[model samples]
Target: MATAKQPVTAPTVISVDDFLAGNPDERRRADAGRLRAIMGELTGEPAVMWGPSIVGFGSYHYTYESGRSGDAPLVGFSPRKQNLVLYLTGGGLEERDDALLARLGPHRAGQGCIYLRRLDDVDESVLRQLIERTVQVHRGVDGGSGR
Candidate 1:
C-alpha cells in the first residue's frame, strides 16, 4: 500500500491581535500595524497568521516541477528584530517592480521578499504599488485561486 502524502502548508493559527500584542517593543508593534493595513488594503483580504510569526493576506496553492506542493500567502509580512520582512508570492519582482522599489527608498530585496527597517524608512505609496502588483501577478498565475 502507498503511504498518504503529507500536506506542506503550515497551520494557519495565531490571531492578528495576539501576534501584534505579543510584540514587546512598541516600535515593532506599530510597524506590524502599518504592514497589516497595507497588505489588507492591497489584497482586499483580511490578514491571517501563518505559522507563529507571519501575518498573511491571501493564499495560493503552488506545485513545484519536482511535484512538491504547498499553499502560501499571496502577500505577507513579519515584524522581526532586525527588519520588517515582506513576502511577495509568484516569484521575484519584475522590471516595473524594480522601478517601484527604486523609488521605495531604503530597503533590501530578496527573491520574493522586501525588507524594511521601519515604515518611515520607505515611501508608503510605492510600497502599496509593489504589493498591488504582487497580488495581481500571483492572482493571474493561478486564476485567483487563493482562499
Candidate 2:
C-alpha cells in the first residue's frame, strides 16, 4: 500500500500540442505525432503534461527513501531535441534486459529514462513490450502499476 506522489509542478504547460508548437524542427514535430500515436495505442490513456516539458500518459505515485514523493507517468514518451525519451520504472536499462535493449536499437539509459535518436531507430514492437513489462514490474512492486 504505497501512497501516490503529488506533482511538484502544476500541469500548466504539459500539452503535446504546445510542446510540438514550440519546437521549430519539423522532424521533431513529426516525431511527436508518432510518439503520441504509439503512446495512445499502448496506454489507451491520453497524454498529459507532467511538468512544463514532459508529455505524460497514465500516472503512478512513488515515495523515495528520502521521503520525497512525486507522481510520474505510468508510461510515456517525449521527443527531445537530441533524442526521444521513454520513461519506465526499471532502474534505467538494467543489465539483465540487455537482450531487450539490443532489440531497441541504438540507445542509452539514465536513471529511468531511455534515450533514443528517434522513433525509427527503434522497433515499436520492442518498445511496446518493454513499456508493458516495465509497467507490470512497477505495479507489482509499487502496488499501483496502473495496468
Candidate 3:
C-alpha cells in the first residue's frame, strides 16, 4: 500500500483581516490590504489564506519533469519585515516584462517574485499592467498552455 502524499502548502481558514492584523503591524497592514484588493480584482478570484502567511487569489496546478505536482496561487502577495513580496510567474514573457519593469520604478525581481519596500515607490498603473500580463500568460490567454 502507498501512503498519500501531503502538500507543503494549502489554503488556511485564516481571514485576510485576521492575518493582516496578526502578522504585520498597522503600517504594513495598510499595504497588504491594498495588494489583497488589487490581486483579488485582477485575478477575479476570492481571497484565501494560503499556508500561514500568503494571501492568495486563484490557483493552478503545476507538474514538474520529475512528476512532482502541486497547486499554487495564480498571483499573491506577502508582507515581510524587509519588503512586501509579489508572487508572479512572469509566464516566460520577457520582452514585455523588461519594458514594464523599466518603467515600474524601483524594485527587485527574483524568481517568480518581485520585492518592494513600499507600494508608493512604484507606479500603480504599471504594476497593474504587469500583474494583468502575468495572469493572462499563466492562464493561457497568451495562446500557450497554462503555465
- TM-score of model 1 (CA atoms): 0.85
Candidate 3 stretches greater than 4 Å from native:
90-96, 144-147
* Candidate 3 residue lDDT tens string, 31-97: 8889888998999999888888888888888777678778888888899888899988744544447
lDDT of each: 0.80, 0.72, 0.81
Worst 10 contiguous positions by lDDT, candidate 2? 138-147
Q: Can you list the residue pairs that collide in candidate 2?
A: 5-61, 14-49, 139-145
Candidate 1 lDDT over 50-134, as tens digits, reads: 8888888887777776777787888999898899998874454644467888999999887788889999989998888888877
lDDT of 3 at 28: 77
Ranking by lDDT: 3, 1, 2
TM-score of each: 0.85, 0.80, 0.88
Specify the highest-lDDT model's number.
3
State how far residue 131 of model 1 sits from its true place (Å): 0.4
Model 2 per-residue lDDT tens digits across residues 11-101: 5555568876788878877888888777777777787887777777777666776766666787776678898788876453556456787
Candidate 3 Cα lDDT to native: 0.81
Clash count for each candidate, listed in order shown: 0, 3, 0
